[model samples]
Target: MTVREDVHSAGIPVLCQSCEARHRGVCGALDPDQLVALAKTSSKHRVEPGIELIGDAETVDSYSNVLSGVVKLTKSLSDGRQQIVGLQFAPDFLGRPFKVESAINAEAATAVSLCSFPKAAIERLMKESPELEHRLLKQTLNELDEARDWMLTLGRKTAAEKVTSFLLMIARNIDPTVNPTAKSATFDLPLTRADIADFLGLTIETVSRQLTRLRMDGVIRIENNRHLTIDSLSRLERRSGA
Candidate 1:
């Protein structure tokens, strides 16, 4: 199974990985001892929903990797409108890796779980392991890919297309890289109407209107405000042009 790689989370705590070759999840480099040391030094953290996990333009003491739930990397404009720059799921890292401070606000879109590691210790570990650096580079590439995809989603897709596209993007419970044939998946929704509007470049009214239309049309069955159940994956995929 393809696993979700961890980013350097700015919020949350760190955890241990026994019987592991890397300190974090499948970091792809590092020996067992190095992984153990990293895990030992890292601490775990939890946050309730709607909390700011990482403040805007603030330097964090360490980095983090998400264990569960969702997070939004957002930013505010001069007009006081907050835009969600990134939406992160589990096994993803959160903090600024090379930079001392993060550029956006890291908020818990849902109740979040994660692990944090001291930046100083991580920097020291990097000096000892060039292999870890390579792994970090790979992680950086993955993050860039995600960013590019979001750019397309935000810049190109239409409203109906955007909602359908969003469903397709989150359709799989497994890694997007390895699960092409894996349909019939389940995962959690990361954004509220406000968050969705900001991410989709639509207003709250537009987002709610679109969602109400979708539910009325039977494109999806909403178990509640937070949970969604897809009645027809093929239909949704067709709508998304996937």
Candidate 2:
């Protein structure tokens, strides 16, 4: 792996000091001096789609914050069946704190950028900063809530409902800064058809068919295979059974 070290005249990485996620991410728990110390030990890397950042059952050596793009977490069965269990977006912290090994595989779902820190550095900070610990706890609880919601969707929702629910999730969470009152939003789909199928427990053809149906119904407009515009988020939410 190639590592890039970008430092400013002040001896801190410009990327770190100017990070858009600074106030919203784990770094928000740190002070300026702490950020500098952490930045000194960190590296920013641009990773390709499909790059596995961590493997199931692998020893955890570091932590990362997604700077951009999406990451999918997956688990595999002994029989070779695999399912995408979760997705992580920008500013989301990676790795399980207090655990030395991972239970799921984390891979880039698109071209991604991340700021990574060694586990030792993060542990040291957490021990010294109660705010950091609190931040992690809050994030864990949010993930738990999402997991429960997804469970309900998977267990009881119809295929069309499941697909709309997934799209609604993307719209609501993809950009934290998006205006809540905005009637429409446009963005690229982060997952491939096959990945979406695995995540939704459907076949790839079903995923595509549902998307087409949604387009025809005027809930969304597919600009291409990857780009889409939600014509009316309200209508989409109703279709999602929300």
The candidate maximizing lDDT is: 2
Q: lDDT at 230 for candidate 2?
A: 93
Residue lDDT tens for model 1, 77-177:
87987777777765566776778787889888777766677888777778889987776777778889978877887788778777777766666532333
Q: Give the Cα-based TM-score of candidate 1 against the true structure.
A: 0.80
Tens digit per residue, CA lDDT, model 2, 1-242: 43555432355456766675677888889887778888878888888888999998999999998888889899989898888999998789999987889999999988878888899999999998999999999999999999999999999999999999999988876765678688898889989999898899999999999999998888898876889899789999999976
Residue-pair clashes, model 2 = 0
Determine which window of 10 residues in candidate 1 has minimal summed lDDT: 12-21
Q: Show where candidate 1 strays beyond 4 Å.
A: 1-28, 173-181, 231-234
Q: Whole-model lDDT for model 1 versus the true structure?
A: 0.68
User: Each candidate: what lDDT?
Assistant: 0.68, 0.87
Q: What's each prediction's TM-score?
A: 0.80, 0.93
Least lDDT summed over 10 consecutive residues: which range in candidate 2?
A: 1-10
